[model samples]
Target: MWELFLTGVDAVMSVQIMILIVLGVAVGIVFGAVPGLTAVMAIALCLPLTYALGPAAGLSLLVALFVGATSGALISAILLKIPGTPSSVATTFDGGPMMEKGEGVKALGAGVVFSFLGTIASIIALMTIAPLLAKVALRFGPHEYFAIAVFSLTLIATLSTGSMVKGLFAGTLGFAFATVGIAPVDAIRRFTFDEPNLNSGFDMLVVLIGIFAISEVIKVAESVRSGKNAAIGSVSMKSIKGFGFSMKEFFGQIPNATRSALIGIGIGILPGIGAGTSNIVSYIVAKKRSKYPEKFGTGVLDGVVASETANNAGIGGAMIPLLTLGIPGDAVTAILLGGFMIHGIQPGPMLFISQGALVYTIFVALIVSAVLMLLLEFYGLRIFIKLLAVPKHILLPIILVLCVVGAFGLSSRVFDVWTILLFGLIGYGFVKGGIPPAPFIIGFILGPMAETNLRRGLMLSDGNFVGFLTNPISGAFLLLAVLSVAWHVVGSLRARKNASTELAQA
Candidate 1:
């Protein structure tokens, strides 16, 4: 195993492989830091480019994109008071405050460092644990898969920042959208709107880009309308020193970071929840356990660390299911499915046995990509911070063009372009109505998989609904989902009661 790892490391260090890793990280960071562009969009648009590269090269491209994109989210989260990715939304909890306080460089530095460490830690864990985990995942049948999906869907409350009703609606819409296309089991089609495109349902990436990116453009336009072009805060290494590693601070946060990473990896390795939801899970736990919870949104490094680390850890965690079981843990991994297929490789058990070397190579590449992320963010911090000055009017127009290009670029067809525009309007409406967008993307991405598995599970049990609870793993997940909802409902009630009590006392 040691020799194989060394071999993989040697292979990753080759000039071509190294160049691809750097190039992919650079591209992903740029895409991820920008509101309208995303890591999935970057990889999806670049899938064609990978066709000419070797297996290791292609894996390097995708993994580097994943690593860089997850971390790059913090750039916009800090500088723009907008999350570059859903995963970075939590960063805005404190990151925006830091940026507003002119400590933007320190926040960026803290985020970049922790994000790199998270990636490195998760990559090491993935390399060590995937083979063992694969053996266990092999035991999952359709019912278990259904259970996992349920467990993942329960995260909607966790993902929703302000309102549960809106989050549920977004999540439900996603599940409903998944019901589009031909049914996975009986091949029956539902909700196609009789349009051929609807037959395949909405592409989650399109939905993600539309919801986060397109809605952002509309929001930016409004900000510009208000004549709000907050001066770009200057970022520098000198200003970043305050956030440097400290033993006391490090010990205090070790548990939070570790637990958050574990949470992120677990959610990320799940089939549907993905990093978008995973980061928030980490942040909530970190904040809940924080010695100074009230200090979380107050421009603190701990908040930045908790979020940035978990999201990066999620990248490595999401890869486990994709590489081991051919099950994509998220939309980004789903696109990676295409990348692997383009290289004539299958992603199941055989992937490990037949392509062990390549898997190891990808793992090595992720570690290298993590290092590159740190280096780039540390030195190029000013470039992203400067985005704050481009004037909202100019940036919004560029965003509009980029959205069109990104969507159309997926298929080189105008149909996808229109899809982006339509969804963009939907996203804008969702935001305007105070709806949370995270669950919608989650639902869209998991829709087909959930639908297919639901049908398969039914068929396996001759359409017996009770079969869902007959299996231990499936039963456990179902119980957890129910308990999760119950917990949230109770917590909401208590918080309301407490607020009322305080109001009465006052």
Candidate 2:
């Protein structure tokens, strides 16, 4: 192992590999910091360019981009109160609040630092116990996957702020929209309305950009119409040092960061599920475990730590299954699997033996990219904050244009542009109606996973509904989901009872 490590270090230390790593990280950060662009989009666009490069160099570049893009999400999540990527959704909950409190620098610093830690943690896992974990992941059947999806969907209740009914409604609406595409197994179209564009269903990017970016633009337009100042409030950066956080505070968050990283890794090891889910789940777990749960969305560092750490850690977690089992863990890794195939490389149990040097090169490149991400984000924090100085009227229009371009670029379909517009209006309506958007996003992502797996699981069990409960892993998760609902119901009843008692006494 030491010899292979040294071989990898030697291969990746070449100037060509080093340069590609730097370039990829830089470009990835740009993509991740911008709304409407994602690491998947970045990798997809740049994938063709890698054909000219060697397998090791090309994989290095892609891995670097993956690392930087994942970490870069925190910038927009903090500065603009919008998640630049789906993985950063939970970051906006606390990061937006921190920015409002003039602690934008602190939020960015914590995000960057914890992101580095999370990536490093996962890298260590990949290096040491990847095969072991991959074997464990293989035990997850369709039943287990459905259970996991259902369990994750239940977390939307935790994300709901005020009205559970509205939250569930938003979640159900998102699931309904997901159903617009073709049915998974039967291949029968449901809600396409004879439009060719609807056959493929709504793209996640379109939905995200519409709900977050376009809706934000509309909200700002409303403020401008009302003659309210359309500028983001100024944030102070003076006298800030070393990631804008204290060592004491850093030490305090070690447990939270560790737990979040573990969650990210676990989620990433599962095929189909990705950091997009892990970040939000981590935030919920952090809040549940927090001594100050009430402060989660109110500009707390713990929330940022939980979110950033988990999402970035997923990079390594996603890689574990991809490399050891030839299974792509998430959408980004699925694309990465293509990159490997394009280079005439196949990943599986034999990959480590057949391409040990290249594998180590990837490991080295990941470490280098992580370090670069930390350095670049730290230096770039000032530049990111400068965007806050741009008047919202001016800045928002540029963002709006980017969102349109991004939506149109997905498949070059004008219908997607229209889809974004429609969803944008719907999102704006959601704001006006006191509905939370997070639950909707959760439902949109998890509902399909649950549905597809439920169908498959039932088929595998000869249409027996009891099959899901017979599997220990699936049964455990389902029980947890039920317990979660029951706990919340009991809590609500107690709260109403207490309120009634107070009213009677008065």
Candidate 3:
């Protein structure tokens, strides 16, 4: 083990490898900070470029990009109240408010520092516990997967944060969207309307651009028309020296950061659920556990810590399942699976045995990438703040153009562009209806997984529905899902009761 570790260290220590890692991190930050672009797109674009490099160098670049992109999302989330990636959605909750309060430097600093810590923590866990975690993940069958998906969907209760009915409606709408293409099991088309483009269904990228980027543009347009553009606020380009926080505050956030990182790692190890879910889940958990839960959405550092930490940690956690089990945890890692196969590297137990040094080298590269991401983002902080100075009227139109370009870039289909515009309008309607888009996005991402797995589980059990309960893992997850919904109901009832009592007294 020691010899292989040393060999791995030597491989990544080369000047060329170091340069690639830095370059990749820089490029990834740019992509992630820009609305409508994401780490998945960055990795996809760089895929062909990897063909010209050595396997170690190519993979290292991708790893660096992954680290940088995840961390880079905080830039837009804080400065513009727009999440650069879905994973940064929770970050926008508190981060945007912090920026409005002229604490942009502090928010960005905390996000960057915690992101580094979270990535490092997850990498350490991946290095030490990957094989064991992979073994555990192997036990998950179709029934278990379906149950997990159900439980994940129930998290919409936590994300709703406003109206449960609206949340459920939005989530159900997402599920309906997911079913537009061919049926998973029967391969029968459902809602194609004779359009060849609908055969493949709506691209996730198109949906994301439409919901986030295009809708944001529409909202900005409305604000401009109403002459309330001042609500968007301005960024304070405050000079921050170190991390822009007192040592006491840093110590205070340690527990939240640790818990969030662990959640990220656990979720990352699970297939299907990615940092996008982890960030929100972690933020919810942190808020529920905090002494001042009421301050969560009001620009608290705790919220930023939980969000940034978990999403970045998820990168390492995601790598664990990908490398050890050959299962991609999320979309970016799915692309990475192709990167591995392209280099003739098949990830699994045997791959580890066959290429111990190479695997270790990749691990080392991940750690290096985390450190590089921190340094790069820290130095580039001022530049990102400068971007906030761009007027909303000008900036939003640019973002709208980027959204169109990004949607069109997906498969180069005009149909996807139309999809973006359609979803943009739908998202705008959702906003007007006071429905949170987070639950909808989550439902859209997880709906197909749940449907496919449920069908597969039933088929495996020979149409015996009881088998889902008979399986211990599946039963446990299903029970948890039910309890989650029940808990939400109980909380809602208690709140309403309290409100009624207060009204009567008044």
Candidate 4:
């Protein structure tokens, strides 16, 4: 193992490979920091480019892109209150608040540093326990998957944090939207409305851009119309130094970072679920475990650390299933699977025996890419701060144009652009109604997974719904889902009662 590892290190240490890693990380950061553009899109665009390069160099480039893109999401989430990707949604909760408090540097630095640490932790786990983890993942059948989705959906309550009723409404609405396309099993069109465009349903990217980016543009426009300066807060480069926090502060986040990284890795190992879920789940876990949970969304480094660490750690966890079982963990890894096939390399148990050196080389590249991402983002911190100084009126228009371009770029269809516009209006309405967008996004993403698995589980059991309860794993997850929803409901009621009692006393 050591000899093969050294051979892998030697392969990636070449100047060409190193340069590609750096270049890929830079490009990925640009993609991830931009609204509507994502790491998946970045990898898809670059997929064909790798056809000419050697497998090691090409795969390494993709790895760097994945790492950089996952971490880069913090930039926009903190600075603009727009998440660059779905995975960074939770980052906005505290990161935006931190930026508002002039702690933008601290938020950005914590995000960057924790992201690197998370990736490193996951890589170590992948290298040491991939096969074992893959074996466990194989035990998950449709029943288990359906149960997992149910549990994940229940998290909508936790995500609401403001109004559980509004959160449930938004999540249910998202599930309804997800059902607009043809049924996964029956292939029957439900809500196409005789329009070809609706057949494919709404693209997740379009929804995300509409909810976060276009709505933000509308808000800024409203401010401009009212003759009030768009207040994004002030950022001074002079006030920021050395990642904007003391060493003691970094050490304090170690526990949160470790836990978040573990959550990321666990989520990544599960097929289909990705960093999008992990980051949110980790944030919730951190908030629940913190002694000062009330300070979570009010500009805390702990929130930033939890979100960034888990999402980036998910990159390594995602690789475990992809390499060991020939199964893609998420959309990004699905594209990576295509990259492997293009290179005539089939990834599975035999892959290690057939290409041990190449496997180790990829691992080495991932670790090196993590370090490079940290260094690059750290040095470029000042430049990112300057972005806050850009006039909102001018900066927002550029962002609006990019949003349009990104919408169109999804499938090169004008329909998607319209989708973005429509969702933007809906998102604006949601905001007015006090409905949280996080649960909606989560519901939309997980609805199909839940439905598909449920249907498949039923079919496998010959329509026996009892199997869901009979399987230990499935039963356990379902019970947890019930407990999670109940816990939130009780908490909400208690808080409401307390507020009413206080008001009456006053």
Q: Which lDDT value does model 4 have at 95?
A: 97
**Candidate 4: residue pairs that collide:** none
lDDT of 2 at 461: 98
TM-score of 2: 0.64
Worst 10 residues of 1 by lDDT: 228-237
Over all chains combined, what TM-score does candidate 4 have? 0.65
Candidates sorted on lDDT, descending: 2, 4, 3, 1
Least accurate 10 contiguous residues by lDDT in model 3: 228-237
Name the candidate, 2 or 3, with the larger TM-score value: 3
lDDT of 4 by residue, 206-317 (tens): 7766776677677657766455323444456575667778999999999999999999999887754679889999999999999999999999999999999999989989
lDDT tens digits, residue span 1-506, model 3 = 67877888899999999999998998788767765567865775565567668899999998888988888888988877888888899999999989878888889889999999999999989888875754576677789878866776665534455677777777788878999989899999989998889997887657766775577667767767554322334444456567788889999999999999999998887655678889999999999999999999999999999999999989888888677756455557766775786688977655677877888898889989989889888777666545444565675676566666656665677887889889889889887888877566666766887899899999999999998999998999899878877887898899999999999999
Name the regions of candidate 4 deviating beyond 4 angstroms: 1-115, 122-132, 224-366, 504-506
lDDT of each: 0.76, 0.81, 0.80, 0.80
Which stretches of model 2 miss by more than 4 angstroms?
Answer: 1-115, 122-133, 157-160, 224-366, 380-382
What tens digits encode model 1's per-residue C-alpha lDDT throughout 88-174? 989999899988887777678778878888888788778878888767877888898787766666665444555776777787887
Candidate 3, pairs of clashing residues: none
Question: What would the per-residue lDDT of candidate 2 be over residues 1-506, giving only the tens digit for each residue?
Answer: 78888998998899999999988987788768766567865675566567678998999999988998898878888877878788899999999999888788899889999999999999998998765654565567789878977765664544355566787788788788989879999999999989888887887657766776677678768866455433343456678888899999999999999999999998877654678889999999999999999988999999999999999999999898678756555557756776786688977656777887788889989999999999987786566445434455666677677667767765677887888789889889999999877667657766777899999999999999899998999999899878876777788889999999999999
Q: Candidate 2 at residue 50, lDDT? A: 79
Clashes of each: 0, 0, 0, 0
- Report clash pairs, candidate 1: none
Relative to the unseen true structure, what is the C-alpha lDDT of residue 96 in candidate 3, on a scale of 0 to 100? Answer: 92
